[model samples]
Target: MDAAEALTLLMSPQGRVDPYPTYERLREHGPVVQALPGLYVVTGYAEADELLRDPRLGVLDDALRDQVWPNWRESPAVSSIARSMLRTNPPDHSRMRRLAAGAFSPRRIAGMRDVVRAQAEELLDGMRDRAGDGAPVDVLADFAYPLPVGVICALLGVPATDRPLFRRWAGDLTGVLEPEITVEELAVADAGAAELRAYFAELVAARRRTPADDLTTALVQVHDTDGERLTGDELLANLVVLLVAGFETTTNLLGNGLVVLLRHPGAAAALRADPGLAPAYVEELLRYDSPVQLTTRTTTAPVRCGGLDLPAGSTALLLLGAANRDPRRFPDPQRFDPTRDQAHPLSFGAGPHYCLGAGLARLEAQLAFPLLLRRLPELALAGTPRHRTRLTLRGYQTLPVTLGTPAVADRGTPAGAHPGTP
Candidate 1:
């Protein structure tokens, strides 16, 4: 198969559970391999990092306008949603990012330690109660999926009652980011986007009538003397961006992290014994099995990456998963090592478009994982987990698990689980 066709198969749903081998092959061929016509794939850590920061590489820049077929151009709904930082370049991207940064500031996240812990504990409590004598429980459904969504909802001032709809919208809409999408899937994503927008539109109206001390309210009212206020479309777009980024990414973080732990029982036991290691464990989880596996950038100007000349108007797909496992940058890269002293993983991305919700995401994962383990020390996979049918997102659709005996509260005592706690 040609390079492009190979990548197509690798990104197909049939290969969703294991795309690493294909990534390795591509990396071996060249860190910067041309995947298809007018597109380059960067699999090296150094190169991906540089391109991410390069001014010539952008999202939805003029380059797209030039190359895109008229009939295949982004729909109005898609364009509307893409106006956020994820799909825009600096200046406008920087401005929109800064507006939301304050709410996700490290200080704010630090202050939320108690809140994160409380929510995690509450969620775990419910999970433990429901898991009677060894019943097969879906960890993704019971734990990972709910934590980040709950946190984002609380932060966005989204009413608790309305979260179910947002959850469905996020699940369907975020699938568009996958590398290879079928026409039917694309249509579903488009419909989901429209529904999400309509839902948020009503939400915005409600919030405008009765302002709450939350990110949504802050975004609407935040202004500079120079008259910098998010426009109506911008507000809706950003809210959608925040919702997807804030929840879905971290949902995968938890799901993927659990799978990593399952693969390493010794490390799991170690973490269970020393809860203080939670932060490092969480960081390592991001590196070991990143939630986001790839990112797209189109060249606005000809540039050289990995000693290859990439022409203007070309697309560069950064293989973050492969980059994270590059042996040159990470020794024994395939090994899952929580004790490794890597500075930071590309899991949250880098440069101008680095994930804005990084702090909140880390906080939620750090708190949630330990609480989960502490609550059920004997947790093990109930059956083979089915990963989501998504290429961009490295996460599970269901994580069936069985819990061990539960311990006491606060004393590191494992929660008591009924016989066969699944």
Candidate 2:
């Protein structure tokens, strides 16, 4: 299949289910190929890396939206995304990113390491109990979903009780990120975005009234040297971005990582034995099956890339998943090797728009994976995992797994303790 055919297939639901083959077909055409009028697709690692960092290629924001689709802002879902730092260019992006950076500092992320491990252990214990009943546990619900949500909530000073609500809203809102969402989905996304905005507005106000040692409080009080800071709308939009972006991608990462680990028993065993290998293991997991499949950027000016000189305002869809698996970049790209040297996948992207929460996500996964494997040594796939029907953010909707057997007796015995004695 040519690039056009491949892109067509990729936009289809079936193609989203498994787009690797389509990516391979597109890559055969060239690193970068125009799939449609004024739209290019980058399937090679080098091209994607370069384009992601290119100043000429920028996020398609409201200004660009006006140029492309006259009625773009008519959709609330689209407008909400447009306001986010995720889709903004330099000045606005830089300001928003700088304000949010304080909360996600290395110090803060390191402080949360213990918190993540604790959450992981508690969830694993619950999974253990569920497995004791001889019923399969949905890992997505029991473990992957809750762990990241809890961590992000704590970071954002969101009450733990509101987790279920966040999960529901996040689910609806994330559909907006997909390329081919239905009208019904768009309606739901609109409602979700409005509700989320209102929720954060209240939260931000409360933070101002009584500041706490959390990310939200920091954001509310943060100001630049010249007393510049996030305006009300900027604050609301970015807060929504933080809350949703915080857990959504990490949830997918954990889910995808577990699936990969379960499929590769040797890797799982290795991780279980030496938890210290988690950092490297997590990197490999990310590269092997990235949580995010693709991201887009538009040309700000006429620029040459991949031996092609394109006109201004051209859209380039960077296929991150394909780039991660590009043979030229990664030797034996398909293989899952935890000890792979210098594995720097574009899963979190690159340059200015690189995921701000990348470090936190890495910390959570690094801690959670080790804790999980150690606690649930017998974990195994109970049934076929169901991947969420999201092309952009790829992860399991329901990952059914059996925790094998309870590592501890039900009679209030600690794990690894002698049941009869203790």
Who wins the TM-score comparison? 2
The lowest-lDDT stretch of 10 consecutive residues in candidate 2 is: 413-422
lDDT of all predictions: 0.79, 0.84
| Candidate 1 weakest lDDT stretch, 10 residues | 413-422
TM-score of candidate 2 versus the correct structure, residues matched by position: 0.93
TM-score of each: 0.93, 0.93
- Give the candidate number with the greatest lDDT: 2
Candidate 1 lDDT over residue span 207-238, tens digit each: 77998989987886763123355667677778
The TM-score that candidate 1 achieves is: 0.93
Error of 1 at 159 (Å): 1.1
